[model samples]
Target: MALGGCANAWAAASSASLPFDDIAGSFAKNEIVELVEEGVVNGTGNRKFEPKKNVTRAEFVAMADRLLKLAPVDADMPSFADVPAKSWYYGWIEAAVQLGIAEGKSKSSFEPSARITRQEAAVLIVRALKVDPGSDTGSGLDYKDKSQIAPWAAPYVQAAHTLGLMGGADGKFRPVDAMTREETAAVLDRILHDNVWSKAIRQTPNMGLQLGWQNGLTTAQFKEQVKNSAVNTLVPRWFFLEYGSTPVSNHADPSLSSWAKQNNKKVWAMLGNHSDSALTHQILSDGHARAAVIQKLAGYAKTYGLSGINVDFENVNPEDRLSLTAFISEFGTSLRAAGAVLSIDVSPDLGTDWTEAFDYEALGRYADYVVLMGYDEHWDGDPVAGSVSSLPWVQSALNRMLSVVPAKKTILALPFYTRDWTLQSGGASSEELTLIQQGYRIRSVAYNRSWDSDLGQYVVSYMRQGSQHKIWVEDGRSLGLKTMMAAKRGVAGYAYWYVGAETDEIWTSLSNAIRYASY
Candidate 1:
């Protein structure tokens, strides 16, 4: 089964077609889906939303703002050093700060990216609800972590628990630990459905597609991998077009589509631009050519019984942003009307030509999901060597994207491969390694492995050929951490860049980390 999802969600998803592929059988499944549909909250945009991934301060505040129907008492977004005005959560922060529901981490900074502790969440929830912090009964709090609760937040924690807005498990509050996205949803749902606040507060909030790419894989090979993986949506690289100036390279195969139906898998055929910026610009800039291209691709999707079209245009010119958005709008309109969906791949905003061409906000509007290629942080030619997609780097990129694209419409793409950078004079050289190769490399060498807290990844270094080799490894440990960060932020689903590159053990680790986690 694919991930559980609301029936209204289009494009792709996780178990049994849930709005989110990751939370099908979770304790908070019903509550999570309901809250997502009601726009009170959002899914992780990936398959699993788990406890290991803590909800950030901004995320908690956004939910509070919506649940409380808050308008920013202070019109200007707070001038916190880390809270940019363009950020999606700043307005929520502004409302939260103005209402005294939250405070900055320091005088100059809000540290909006930091995770919100359990006590912090309780305090904010209680304040937002305007529920009086009821008198603290000494006996009401008996958590194992009681001593860890901050003094200022103690009464609010007790009041929140008494109000049934928050609860402890296994008799431990872990007061200073971060709140998971699912926990946030449970509390928000309680406020609107399970408690008196539902009657007192009349408000509404607004808000996966788990997609895996199939690179030239025959149906047999692809089907085998599906058995061991949690990927419910199949994105096959089936077609290529040159602004429709030439015949589209038709790589369609009916057997794959047939198998998809039998196995309840979704096939989103890709239409790539050959990584030609000029070719992409030609069609995007020309109305006639653009319309013709969309008609052909949408027709192909309907003809092939596919779920949707995945647009993988790369190396686009910055000046073509408007044209790109226009093409997406026109293409998406036709697809939706034909009972199909649209998803677009985008690079992180690095103020470069490769990314400047993408208008994430605009594309997100037209397409059902904007798939962020969440890797290449340290690309092939970069002078420095690092994990391709470090946890912190991915976190920053996700925050930037969510500031524009709605969490529900955003999909984070995970990399199944890592780079082995070989240090050389003046600069460095690197070679791509599959999950299997990287695993073998780590085990084969007499290297020193240590955890990098900042990257949330393991760093393995060794000396050979008179040069020190530093490998920011991407193994089960790193992948799990990245997924946790995604779940923490609350996205729609996740997409592995391509299948067939992972080690055998990778799937088991992925299942444990991204699949069966309880919030």
Candidate 2:
């Protein structure tokens, strides 16, 4: 976990991963170093960043594509006269144009090799951030060189400066000067760690606390089991975002916060999007709606004394990938300003509506923690019956996530339930089985069981109703072993899916594993 003390040894190590041989003593050295760690920008080769080199239209497009994870776009012919299908940056240019972020030198010419000026860069960045141009076009500028800015580009330049995406030197806007590689990196760094983002003190903290989510449980029902469980951080699925400018609470429970305050536990309220992609698009794309939700969520966090917020937006449209990134950055800034941490839930990077919108690298930078939903290796939709979250699958997914997200900022979410897979007629279907229910089922049926050492789980099989039933059991033993394995990776912490689904022994096993693992 590299986020120790927020920016500790791990951060230092990551920064050194790209030791640009030429950036020493440059004004943008720190910014260059930071972007390198995020895997957003790179050197020119031979360990040199060529910080003073000028950026071209094509070069800027490539860098912006990596930072935004823009959706791919295809074209039957060239997107422009200069941007041909054979070029390395053809798709990125097409995306830039179709996504409404870029412009061409002429009606037919993109001038891919032409140097881009600072004002042009500002226009592109403001468009890419998806914010409308400043309405009071003539009032936003204060730079000494403001007069030099093109009249047509004044609004975008004003918006870019107001958003802190671009700045001037010696109060000079330098609108006509070309942006250097180092200057470009500074802009990207500001995007990742904006003025508001500096308020986020705990990029990753207190990974030792045992965490669990709560849904559909009253205070009385939850307290009964939680009082004796190993859990210390409680995340309630309480808030929600609805269509257009109106966000709803979905009946948020305040008693849970009362309990957390009295019990020496922490509370992080969860916000869901109802898996509605169009609605989410409205929130992310509309500046007013996005700000309202951030304001409302931040107010709720403050009012409820929430230690953090757990975002569980799922089934998002992939086209909203960059928009989601922008929202998280803004929302997290607001949450941290209100003294709440931001932890976003993400599925393993795969081909599902639930997983497509997330760009892990961007999310990791925007949120304090990235909770990897380390389950659903073999979902109910799969034709084969297998472990809901096999040990190998969890291990692989966690490792892949750590490559982009810092380990200290990554949380592994464990499944508190498994599946009773039924195989018949060359098709397979499965029933979700809670930890306690699986234990009961194993006792009632004649089962053949064995430990798959490689998977770190118990494989059980039984025959009933003329079909073979296979259960990759998730019990205290298996879960404990999985915890121990994850601990070795130095992840920030672990979190289970939901509360009230497991027996008391599961907590005991997990607590011991978390405490005793030799990390």
Each candidate structure's TM-score, on Cα atoms with residue i matched to residue i, is: 0.61, 0.59
Q: Report model 1's TM-score to 2 decimal places.
A: 0.61
lDDT of each: 0.76, 0.79
lDDT of 2 by residue, 1-519 (tens): 545666676555665664875786588999988878777788888888999999998888777755664433433334366787788777668656643467688756889998889988988887766678956563667888788988877888888888878878898889999999999999977877764333332142233757788855787887777887777889888888886436756556788889889999999888999988888887888787888888988888888899999999987888889888998999999998998899999999876766779999999999999999989898868888899888888888888899999988988899889999998987999998888788788878987776576877768899998889999988665676678777878888888877888865566556545543431
Overall local distance difference test of candidate 2: 0.79
- Best candidate, lDDT-wise? 2
Query: Which pairs clash (backbone N, Cα, C closer than 3 Å) in model 2?
Result: 1-408
Question: What's the true lDDT of residue 467 in model 1?
Answer: 80
